[model samples]
Target: ANNPIWLIRNGELQSFGPDKQPIGTHGGEQNPFTLHEMQLEKGDCLYLFTDGYADQFGGSKGKKFKYKQLQELLLSVHKQSADEQRRRLDETIENWKGGLEQIDDILIIGIRIL
Candidate 1:
């Protein structure tokens, strides 16, 4: 997992803090994720993901899909469109998981610079 950041209107740091320290928003009650403004001139891409994708189980016999594998997969399909990237990633996960039941919610967001 990664800490999400945002940049809106004049690069204002609209981040919340508690006790003068960077804390979750809404009185430190919510962990909000945001992608304020994306800077993609062209031929650029961004991949955001949650832990469930790597925590999945199934492969050959049955094993957790490690982060390394996910990174490799992303690198392999980095050239595809956002939609295509999502499709391929989902397909890859499904194939790796085979018939294993999903353990948790999986979220993957891909933004292509176009």
Candidate 2:
């Protein structure tokens, strides 16, 4: 599934955009990417990521990690420091992907408005 920009504000998790790949190597007359604009307040957290994390095939029974699980994980850690959040995310995914080769590149950028 395509990845949506995840935002956490006032302890709520929200998702937006991702109509298509943000960047594509092949140039074509495809519909222009949608521009998303929003107001972020102090303590709000935003996450931008590639689909690899959620698309990863892991965990017991070797199932996909899935967006719902990823959402829950993010919500649980949005309140932590950036470094801690990074560590937890890394550890969790690694543990989940144990003994399996990674399926794709994973990139997650998390920002906390101050």
Candidate 3:
């Protein structure tokens, strides 16, 4: 998954992660993964995910769902509880996929600080 990290801080939705590598192998360019630090306020949320969902081939034209739509979905669900957001995300993907078989493993984690 190219896009592995996302954050909603201070009512803004932003994406963060390394550009050269994936979860392992250190991207070949470096010996170790680069780390980032950010300050979070109350009610802030963090998200980490793999590319399965966005890479899915579906929709009217039968193309990949892509990352843009997924980002919009996350922003829209920002007002909801974590569990409800999860449900809506699952529902959206399932509906998008329709009867087609799922092709890859999809993983998403949502963390909100109160």
Name the top lDDT candidate: 2
Clashes of each: 0, 0, 0
Please, what is the whole-model Cα lDDT of each candidate in the order they appear? 0.64, 0.89, 0.82
Q: Candidate 2's residue-wise lDDT over 1-114, tens digit each?
A: 257899999888989968754476556656767778999899999999988999999888999999999999999999999899999999999999999999999999999898
lDDT of 3 at 86: 84
As for candidate 2, its clashing pairs are: none
lDDT agreement of model 3 with the native: 0.82
Model 3 is weakest, by summed lDDT over 10 consecutive residues, at 23-32
After best superposition, candidate 3 residue 97: deviation in angstroms? Answer: 0.3
TM-score of 2: 0.92
The number of the candidate with the highest TM-score is: 2
Model 2: weakest 10-residue lDDT segment is 20-29
TM-score of 1: 0.63
- Segments of candidate 1 deviating more than 4 angstroms: 1-41
Q: Cα miss at 61, model 3 (Å)?
A: 1.1
